[model samples]
Target: MHAPDRPASYAHPARLILILSLAPTVGLGIGRFAYALVLPDMRDTLAWSYSAAGFMNTINAAGYLAGALFASRMIRRFGLAASVRWGTLACVLSLALCAITGNFYVLSFARLLAGVGAAAGFVGGGALAATIAQSRPERANFLLSLFYAGPGIGILASGLAAPFVLQGFGPGSWWIVWWAMTALAVVMTIPVLLAPFHARAALTETTAVKFAVAPVVIYLTGYFLFGAGYIAYMTFMIAYIRDAGGGAAAQSAFWSLIGVSAFATPWVWRRVLALDRGGLATTIILGVNAIGAAMPIFGHSVWLLATSALVFGVAFFAVVGSTTAFVRFNYPPQAWPTAIAAMTISFGIGQTLGPIVVGAITDALGSLSFALNVSAAMLALGAVLSAFQRKVRSF
Candidate 1:
């Protein structure tokens, strides 16, 4: 048994931290990550061109970028609770609107709204978690890991849920899934609202911290490459599998495998960080992702797909954990948010362009294999960047 004054392992403080940390994951993962899973279905139903679908993703990333830039001020002015509630409400409403209509313009608008809401939620939640973890470094690191795990969980949940929901309800039932997701979002918001807001000085700082900006910039570049490869894979993996003659069960299983692997990321990276060579670890993870991206190009076999998913899953979460931890260790406490925001914005930019670039590549080559290869190349570039980043400690 643990000491009573030690916050009781996994009790109030731990549970609260976990819950709040999960808010961004649900907000971004469900609202954003799930969008890709459903896109193929939506495209078929709505007769959307590839460019149109890609544009939707770009719009969302744009909103997320804007929200990240402004969210700190919003939280400072309104407090964490109000910001969370407002963001949740926006997400719920946007998803609801998406369910009710198939108009391309309206769908784009809804996605934008959802993106903005998700961004706000992510920024606020991350800031809050960082604040709480400041004094309790171990707990803080755990909470940070938990925050990123939300998306992996969301991806797994949606990947499993989307196919069954679509099959059971028949055509045009994508709206039903959206509505259900909206309901889930609203329900999840209740717990968040009830939880006490533990304000910390680390949460409110908007100024640049002590780290040299150059290395941070290089890190952002690598981060951008990561976003491109990861998003492209996530956005199209299910469809790619299905297109290659895999059954619905196979597709679902593939995503589940990815999710399960992703779920272990925080635990794995925690050990990696203990080595105190986060830069090298990051390079290795990015290289792994590049290899994963190349797997599908070899063949469309089910075994290959499964292997690719697992590799991608492990690499994806590990990279996120390593990069975020890198920021925490390298930067001063006050500048953490700005550094994170800067990195996230670079990610958003990559994500914003990735889908469209993939779509264009697919159009040109008439196969996802080419697109996957392009993504692999980008990951390779990121790996190089990661290695180069080690020389400069300031950024």
Candidate 2:
């Protein structure tokens, strides 16, 4: 089924994975996480409450959940290039809309559409990565890890650029940052455009495999909590720093450090991730992440915030890789799509609820600190749940 007319530039796996990494850069880095950097200004300029601000992300997560459910079917029908192209194209336009509007409802709708686009790009790119890794099983794990780490590139770019964009355009122009993000996204689109749609010729997976989720239920639950807990910190950390009187330099340093640390994840956790201990590896990592999430509350020192950023940044992205590794370790190849999709849906549901709930807590408790404390507690709870999961015996 290979397309003879497809571009030959991405014919190799390494080259393909390199290009595929940009999918996350667009999907998560700009589509999702960039909101945090611009949140304070958006709040002030739009005159929105904490609850309303969080609702923006809530709608985004809802769209992401919907897209996750549909992406597989889309890939099956339309093929990878089309899926990724359309998804990234839509996401680019959605971000463009963000720069053009000041209406709260309109902005929320744009966020929602961006989420949908992000999911398509993410899922389609992930599938391509999987197919590529499968073709060369010896380097599968590293290739997959490389793909997931792509968001760090986006994170770093946003971290460095957002502050200057704000400074350059002056404080009240939050929309300018959105435009900068859109331009960066457009530049990243080139690699994708050059990628071909062909996967290996014999790449058929079973559609009728029946597998039990009981063994991994606890891991799945922990992942859900991880989703719920970690996002609140990302969604609110910039605002928290501002309230604590930290300046733009501090914000840029903190966020950029997190992004830089994330890029080193594959090397840092290569040994643990290589283990087949099921959720034990995940639990330990989540414990470290919980500590990082709580660090800002422990002290107002610059070193403390930097440490928090480095720790959380390093661990958070790897948690996602851990789940993918878990599925690969526990299931037959045919069942991977099902397993990964289940975990993603669980993660999405948790994310969809996290912002609203944490926002409400922020409103009621009169502090972002209390909301983050709640987030840390959820992560701790997730770690405990993950500790209960054992390796799947059938695998």
Candidate 3:
């Protein structure tokens, strides 16, 4: 008799993706975006100026860039699972520190540390997911999508939980949110611990692929601007809502909608991602996101905010995915790592500049709405740049 076939669950890669995804969920969802939820309270309780608040995210973005630079080396040294495990641990510790301190400098340091940890976890988790995709080539896209969707799960959970906490514990206890996030991070770390790790052979040959900025300059520029524009909106959104007289209930609904929309992004954009028109895919998505980012400034109706959240949520993560797709279509497999790294570094630089600049604008104008309009203008310019890109051809 033939040996019994492996059970579907045993053979399927979903469980592995599920486990790996927790890294992004915590790293991005709580470590990064949760600041938006916590910011209003932090401002009121801590008596922080808008510029000071913006500087916190600016330092965090700088840390994220610094961490990204070192993440590849860490993955090589510690291996993927260990890197992810330790990174998650560091992130939780950072969150815990944020809870314990009310000092401005100390809290800024904590956000910066959290950014570093989040970047490490994000990089390691993505590499692990790529390894799994190689092993299960047929389901590669779906599995990767599931892994990327982890942030959406984190966002959803935070959006749902934060309002309740704020309502129950009151706004003065913003530190409670950080502690709660730390607890969730502890739970999320379990899957990373349980996931199996296998060593792979080292790459023996280096392929010489010449990278030229002129050929894809427009696309790269567009992506960089996208990094700059999207972050400003995300960093200040909660405070903006509160300024507009929105209550916790409205905030919960708006943020949760974004999370829910994010969960459905892979399916929505699968066809668009297949496009190989140099920067067309990215151009379209960025345009949509820019509209979402600008909507609140146009009007403050409940329907407008909800629509903005849904559209913004749907396109936010997928914008990064578009750049990955661009690299895949334009470069050989061996060149992917270098191209992606270059693009990521550019994106990180843009993010580092975005928050502080927006903050300065807000401080000058005394209007978050004006800052958001500036963000939308940047995104629009990015779309224009992306529109000029053509598929790279042999010289």
**Candidate numbers, best TM-score first, in rank order:** 2, 3, 1
Say which prediction, candidate 1 or candidate 2, comes out ahead on lDDT. Answer: 2
Candidate 3: C-alpha RMSD after superposition = 4.6
In terms of TM-score, the best-performing candidate is 2
Query: Each model's number of backbone clashes?
Result: 3, 0, 0
Off by over 4 Å in 1: 1-13, 79-85, 200-212, 275-278, 391-395
Give Cα distance to truth, residue 244, candidate 3, Å: 1.4
Return the top candidate by lDDT. 2
Tens digit of per-residue lDDT, candidate 3, span 169-192: 986889999899888888888878
Question: For candidate 1, lDDT tens digit of each residue in 40-104?
Answer: 78888988766677788878877777777777667667765566667766877887888898888
lDDT of 2 by residue, 210-317 (tens): 657677788888998998999899999999988889777878888898889877887887777777886877887888889999998887788999999999988888
Which consecutive 10 residues in model 2 have the weakest lDDT in total? 1-10
Query: How would you order the candidates by lDDT, starting with the best?
Result: 2, 3, 1
Positional deviation of 315 in candidate 3, in angstroms?
0.4
Candidate 2 regions exceeding 4 Å error are 1-12, 201-212, 393-395
How does model 2 score by TM-score?
0.93
